[model samples]
Target: MKTWILPALGTLVCWGFWAFIPKLTTRYISPMSAMVYESMGAMVIGAIVLAVLHFRPDVSGKGIFLALATGMLGMAGGLCFLFAVRSGKVSVVAMFTSLSPLITIALGYLLLNETITLKEGLGILTAFIAIYLFSAS
Candidate 1:
């Protein structure tokens, strides 16, 4: 058994909590606002970790641009997810969004010429099935 199993289980629990976050966010605030808050919280935590390690922070122009671009993409995705959850069943939206790994795999294949193993291919297919089953109801 992998020693990482406990951490993986903890992550799954956290992910479960995150699934309902869109609904709660859409109820009380704009998705963009929620994403901004989320990003800020992430940044603060990262900064704190670095500080505790006595690491010097680098705010180069390239780093700033990359961070801004990532934040923009995150905000866009969050808004769309919030809209989906508000307009449809949360379980359906969550299941559909779980297919994001497929997007990542596709991008890696296109940009890096990466090859998918049979197991990964099967996982993608199963994700599709899960999406279809969740959305059909």
Candidate 2:
């Protein structure tokens, strides 16, 4: 098997647990409050990762802009997700958001000039339909 499987599964399990936590927190506390604590914890973990890397990662202008954009976009998604779970069914919200790779796929095709095979296109199409049907209820 590929070497990434273990870490990939770890991510899957971690995110599975992550999607559950907000639902639990929103039961007692506000989603915004939960987001406050969650962002703090994430920053601490991010700091640790930086420390472990000895802060050796790229810091060029292009790199900085890309990294900044990534952090901003991810945090925005997290905030939105917290609110989404608070208002909607967790299963529906989670599954719907999980199909976000569709955005990346479309962007890749448009901006990155990436090729999409007919079969992969069909899969993406199916995912879009699934997300729509899942959310429409």
Tell me the alpha-carbon RMSD of every candidate.
3.1, 1.7
Task: lDDT for model 2, please.
Answer: 0.89
Off by over 4 Å in 2: none
Q: Tens digit of lDDT per residue, candidate 2, span 1-137? A: 99999999999999998887888889998977887898899999989999999988766998899989998898888889999999889999899889988889889999999999999989988988988888888
Q: How good is model 1 by TM-score? A: 0.73
Listed per model in order, the count of residue pairs whose N, CA or C atoms clash below 3 Å is: 0, 0
What do the candidate models score in CA lDDT, each in turn? 0.82, 0.89
Please give each candidate's TM-score. 0.73, 0.88
